[model samples]
Target: AEVCYVGVTSSAPSSVARTPEQFTQKLDAFAQKRADVHGQPVSTHTIVSPDPIADLDDDLIKAIKEVGADLVVMPTHPPKNLDVIMPSHGGKVATHTNVSVFLVRPRDG
Candidate 1:
């Protein structure tokens, strides 16, 4: 089974969680919402970053490496001009990491 780490980042000086139970409760709520939307059980390992708000691409790559993820799925907005579309953080991650990335661009409504 693949381990999913739900990362939570905070920039505050106090990095330690106030209460482990409270932290777990919030994470559990998020997991439940995800499961409800997907209509399937979701297993997640939670992570609270000590040093927060680093480069998003670097953070994602670091997280991927930590979990040894074989694949990554990221969502992007549909671009009007495919040729001129700017590279997103997801794109950077794919470029830098050996792991495969599957980018999903939802159809523009």
Candidate 2:
């Protein structure tokens, strides 16, 4: 079945405490739940990788293709300002990957 892949890049050492398999499973469960609610079929794969800011686009594309992902969904942190051209890992991935990508903006409080 075609699956969705979520790539999470973090610089925090503590974030690496969880195994990749564990993280993937959790994401799968969450996706399953949402799919179930919507009466749709969906599968998820999660990749936890260290930040590759210099070549983040390459890293994300590699991960997405490795999982045979049909689509990618990512969340962005709040932007500091309108003029600020904040570097985005998601943006990089979107620009580089061949597959479709969806960037979900964070809710403003």
For lDDT, the strongest prediction is 1
Encode model 1's per-residue lDDT on 1-109: one tens digit a residue: 3436455444343344465445656677877787777777655544455554555667788778877788887777665465367567677888999999888998857
Q: TM-score for every candidate vs. truth? A: 0.60, 0.61
lDDT of 1: 0.66
Which portions of model 1 show Cα errors greater than 4 Å?
3-5, 12-25, 32-54, 80-86
Poorest 10 consecutive residues by lDDT, candidate 2: 9-18
lDDT of 1 at 20: 47
Model 2, 4-109: lDDT tens per residue? 5454544444464356666666677878887777777776645455764555566668878777777777777766574257557777777777778788887778
Each model's lDDT? 0.66, 0.65
